[model samples]
Target: MLISNIEVIPGKRITDHLGLVQGSTVRAKHAGKDLMAGLKNIFGGELQGYTELLQESRQEAVDRMIVQAQAIGANAIINVRFSTSAIAAGASEILAYGTAVRLNDR
Candidate 1:
């Protein structure tokens, strides 16, 4: 399905509004990675482990949101947005959301 952050696709018209769809996932830092991150924080360097972890989590949330859109017969998702929130000391939740819609060639 076509997914874009804009309200409309250049070559397509919105045929139906299927409503909002969202997905979220929570993840915690593993102890080994958390230790490494702590050292990196002190040394002021990029935390590669955490970066990769969050990237993966974000993709998973997007995939889930797409699944929901497909289930409701949406061919595209517009105005896509993402959010991240700390759920606990070492855990965070990532959310992906968008307006599900049917699109047809203009």
Candidate 2:
């Protein structure tokens, strides 16, 4: 299914609105990675571990969102968005949401 951050996809028309679709995943930080991140913090460098984790989470969430859209018979998802939040002391949740729709060719 097609997904876009824009409210509308150029050259495509929204033929049907299938309401809101969303997917989320919760992940915990690894102790070893956290330690490495802490060390990097001193030098103000990128935390590769967390970066990888978030990237994976984002993809997972987006995949789930696509599943939901497919279930609803949607051909595309518009106004896609992602959100991150701390679910617990060591866990974080990533959410993907969008409006499911049936698209018509131009």
Candidate 3:
């Protein structure tokens, strides 16, 4: 499916609106990684572990959103948005959402 952050997809006509669709996932920090991150905080560098974790989490959320759209017969998703929220001291939720729509072949 065509997924875009913009409301309109250039040159593509939307045929139907399937309403909003969303997916989310929660992840907690690995204890070992958290300890490493604490050390890195003192040195002021990127936390590679958390970076990778969030990246994967975002992708998973998007993938799940696509599945929902596809199930509802949507060929595209527009006005895509993402959100991140802390679920607990060491956990966070990543959410992906968009308006599911059908696109004309042309």
Q: What TM-score fits each model?
A: 0.97, 0.95, 0.97
Clashing pairs in 3: none
Evaluate model 3: give its lDDT. 0.95
Backbone clashes in model 2, listed as residue pairs:
none
lDDT of 3 by residue, 11-81 (tens): 88999999999999999999999999999989998899999999999999999999999999999999999
> Cα deviation in Å at residue 92, candidate 2?
0.8
Write down the lDDT of every candidate, Cα atoms only: 0.95, 0.93, 0.95
Angstrom error of the Cα, residue 49, model 3: value is 0.8
Q: Which stretches of model 1 miss by more than 4 angstroms?
A: none
Task: Point out where model 3 deviates above 4 Å.
Answer: none
Error of 3 at 20 (Å): 0.3
Better of 1 and 2 by TM-score: 1
Per-residue lDDT of candidate 2, residues 34-78 (tens digit): 999889989997888999999998999999999999998999999
Q: Kindly indicate the candidate among 2 and 3 with the higher TM-score.
A: 3
For TM-score, candidate 1 versus 3, the one ahead is: 1
Worst 10 residues of 3 by lDDT: 6-15
Number of backbone clashes in candidate 1: 0
